[model samples]
Target: MKKILTILMIVIMSTALFACTTQSNNEIKQDLVVGLEAAYAPFNWTVTSISDYSYPISNQPGSHVDGYDVQMSKELARIMDRNLTIKAIEWDGLIPALNSGEIDVIIAGMSPTSERKLQINFSDEYYRSEIVMVVKRNSVYENATRLIDFSGSKVVAQRGTLYDDLIDQIDNVVHQTPLDAYSNLVAAVTTNVSDAFVAELPVAESVVKSNPSLAIVKLEQGYGFESEESDITVSVGMRKSDTDLLNEINSALSQISVEVRNQMMTEAVLRNNESELTLFGLITKYLSLFVQGVGVTLLLAITGTFGGFIFSLVLVFGKTQKIDKKRDNIFKKIIKRISNGLSTAYIVLFRGTPMIVQAMIFYYGVKLITDISWWTPLSAGLIIVILNTSAYIAEILRGSMNAIDKGQMEAARSLGFSRIKSLLYIVYPQAIKNALPAIGNEFIVNLKDTAVLSVIGVLDLFNATRQVVGATYDTVTPFIITALIYLFLTGVTSIAVNYLENHKAGKELKDA
Candidate 1:
């Protein structure tokens, strides 16, 4: 009873802290909070070091963002006389983030297509470029000049972008599944996962410049994919309610001449090509980031595993509460019934859904209710992991406890031990001894599963690899390093689990 009361107190205090941390500044915003993918080269990409061209990324410490998008955002913020704050977000999450009030504007080289105009208002055009297909240097598609020329070839693009939609324009093309980033598309083409990928002219140029083995196929003007003028022009994305801010942004954009815009893009392209590193060079250069990623991954896995174990105890107790008709009053029986129902519901709900979906719903859903400033990705990620993990661990504990003989509990009661004391002192210890291996497996599972947290911008190993890919434009090397790190972590964990199992078995034999 005391333990349950303490857990309730901690939960209440946490709720209070969460309430206290909410801030309501979106209505009267001070900073120009800009959101972008930061993985689209020349448009926006992440970098390790700060420069005159780079803007600090609010979510990623010790890293910065640079490219044409960042430069345009800088000018916009300066014109508005507001401090600039850039956030690196996944492409698919940008519109949702803007709508949920998590970000003020999006300058992520987003084309203001007719489809997007319904959800959010777009500022005047900031940049324009034609569509082009990128292919392996010596591939047959490299010489193609028309959409029909590439028929029967596999093609892809970044997921949820105009580029991906353009794939349908190619006649009889395989139309492979779109990837999540330009880096992934580049990798797909280079590694033969796909024959080609559609990209904007500047982006194609950036990829070709970074990779000598890739080439661009620019179709004849009349034979190219038909596109609307707005489809080719990138604009600032903001909430529909921000009419005044939209006009002000357009005013700031008008101040820059076409010549200056071209010049800025040229400079950005040059800066994007500044890095010339081999795989080994990139690994050495970005070693610290990999280390930081490993640290965050381990932190989430360890804490999530231990924290889930603790919470699962409470869940087990709730689900297993006795409904004594004779000794229990009507109020007590009702409480027990409710507890069992809730615990069962919680386990079923969490176990039934994927963690990726849960993370997206929880992370974005929280923003709808409170100021996003307090509900950060890491905080939300930890809570999600704990809650999801508790459901599974509860069943594990319950099954392990039940496997023990009823004779043990009856004997304890015969010795005048209370129900709680008997379970805690006699039954739980042996159940834990039986369940240790499964609990250790949960830890290992967390070490790998936490990679999904990256979708919600948790900065786990996978997210770190994506950041490195954004900076270096070499997708293969970063992922290889990340895989190795994951292997090392899981390997160590497995060895530890094996040792604990062996030790437990040996001790039992000795006691016998």
Candidate 2:
């Protein structure tokens, strides 16, 4: 059943990936990849058909891309006549992907804040929305004017947003965790992950329309925030050096109007007032669920760690000791190839290439060669994590082995013990004692690294919380709930590691 599930997951992931990434063959010069949260309705999202809209959305052929940014990009593409591509990346990776030249333009609804400007350039502001609190319908916070009304209350906001920064301005409110996107913000609130969340008007309006169970708490004038806070202007982000792309995007923004942008919003958003929402609905309402994606990440970390360990030990054995036999001779040569290869290429390749590429290859590369889906999300995710982890673990184990005094090996050999026996009994035990802290450290990192699994669609704590934030449009609560969960997991891991260290000291070597 597990194998079948893994295979099925791989197939589904591959199909979704291909559908999302496969490009139409409209001729062009350069591929202009625009990154955005496609789940942001009225701005961008994947729907069954463009025909589903009450009004046509910016003339997009399919039901995927719409809203101000979509319209502007399409209109600009017509002007440039280059193949415009949309790459839906997480909010956090947007600037980095652009800086690394993975994408040409960040058409996501990002604000050109002062800090963000240092890393990337931006086109002029295209669309702006005001920040507001989303709460349960007619709740105490509903129509409650001013920050004082919600003082001592919990508030959540998406990380790195102006809303997050603004949360701190409130003197007494208990700020929970900061989420990464609008979607998780809603999920946070809807799931009672948070009490209320700060979001822009556009997102809040859409959230209320999509989930009728929620209410939008409009701040009365003088809401104790900057005018800029109320005006959450979103613009296209570009790399600092991409002057050409920046200029092209600016030109595109000039031709668009406020009216056309709003029209797209009306068509894309479906009004709903329900209490319960599906993951899909919550995801569409908010794009942050991707952050909490989990199962694959955990699988990736554990398997990667274990694989790296076994592979490392074998390599270490071949490198450190000598063996003699006809079969041993063949094994020695094979080990030599592996050892030398590990030093030269394997280390460089696995460590050098982006994990994302490796993951994509593991997940979808099956389509090119065979019908069999050889990778499960967890297995595939772990394969890369392990490949990367093995390099580090291999180096650590090698170092620890060397740290064992050479004399110990000599004495063990002189005492009539085989090389393998000496290594198993005398060497590895001490090396592991030395490596315990490092191993513990790695596990903690592994826990956090789980967030990366969101790309592959594992809804772990972060991804799950992100869904809540996105759906509730309440960023703080969901994030707080999820963050606490992460902290708890990490804390438990730390306790376990400490216990192991103490146990080894008492039983094996004395003194932890």
Candidate 3:
């Protein structure tokens, strides 16, 4: 038992230490770190293999990023005389990452809109293009050239972007909930979930090229949704304090004339790879990505569950500290009360909120206080799951503790065992045994729930599937594979958990 506990402790500590050490060599190296959503094609998208035009994504292993954004970033880094380091972040996280010093700049094809200018400074326009709508190739609105023509049609856009806000401009339009990624927007339109989705010209072209069933609707100049000049121009984003860096970037942008910028974008479009393979072939081509994603998913789920179980033991002990009114002194009562209050508060706080909300708050909130160089999505995700799971598991253990006969503790005490030993050796073991099934269930729940970690850019199974979809614009096959992989993981886990239960039961029976 001591060996087992020691092993678990070592594993937990080692994992935490490793995560802390995975920080980029920002302090030691002169790399020009940039953040972007590699899921966005033409602008940026994930690729399985490296090419002369592509850079390996810093965080997502076995993946490379290539697009107009990458091209611009590479040129800027070259002109600045710094090596390039790309971090593939979620769209919403780009600004936060820039402001938090997670990356030096955001070269994610973000527009320098008025609202954004308030949060960060921008370099001169790197790429400028008009907005267009993507829809089913032969749909009713295929040949439509005006925004008014699509009135009453379901419109969607990427969340937290100018595109989503523009939906309000369509007269009598059914504005569907904005999706998280451009890939999702493509999927939504392809599946008829939305009649059309707003996108930049390059994005529209990229998707249309990949998806034969989709087409682009370029509204005439006076017929499209009105926008500010800044809204139409994609610029490099930096923290407001990065005035010097911004000036440097603008100088680099100036050196590259309009012809060069246009040529770069043209090359990126031509370089963007689109899969023409059947569903089975697509799966075969991207099977490595799926396996890698599953590995990350299982690593998080298993480590989180085991780590949570161990941490929950501490919480359970805190909450279970007895405060007998008749026998306990004032000091003892106060100490017990404080411990119980903290434990109760932790459980309530985590359980009271959604995991996704908790993930955003915890992940970004930490960035403000410390050098989160070590805090990749995977590391942050592990910590979040462990803390969140501890709360629930603590409650589970507490209930199981309550179910333990009070006489058992008294019996141990009668045999000359101290109160600590009585609980540790006698009470805790039984409580854990009784709570094993619930713990197993939590593991299963976490396997699915960890999908939310993708919002922070953890390339778990779901995020990996999104990357594949983003690349191919064929959502069905990737998701079908993802579903099957998850099903297999959970199914195998269930069997293992049941086997442990039966084995433990048999051991107890034999001992009796």
lDDT agreement of model 2 with the native: 0.65
Better of 1 and 3 by lDDT: 3
Runs of candidate 3 with Cα error greater than 4 angstroms are 1-29
lDDT of 2 by residue, 266-297 (tens): 54454312245554554454343333244434
Candidate lDDT scores, in order, read 0.87, 0.65, 0.87
User: Which model is ahead, 1 or 2, in terms of lDDT?
Assistant: 1
lDDT of 3 by residue, 1-512 (tens): 99999999999999988776765444444678999988788888888777888898888888888888898889988888788999988788788777877789999888888889999998888888989999898899999988899999999998888988999999999999998877778778888889999999888888888888889889998999899888889999998887888898898889898999899888888777574668788877788888888999999999999999999988988888888899799999999999999998999999899988998888877887798468878899999999999999999999999999999999999899987899889999999999999999999999999999887879899888888887777767788888898999999989999999999999989999
- What lDDT score goes with residue 458 in model 2? 39
Q: What ranges in model 1 sit over 4 Å off? A: 1-29, 274-276
Pitting candidate 2 against candidate 3, the one with the higher TM-score is 3
Question: Is 2 or 3 the stronger prediction by lDDT?
Answer: 3
Instruction: Tell me the TM-score of model 3.
Output: 0.91
Cα shift from native, residue 323, model 3 (Å): 1.4
Q: TM-score of every model?
A: 0.91, 0.58, 0.91
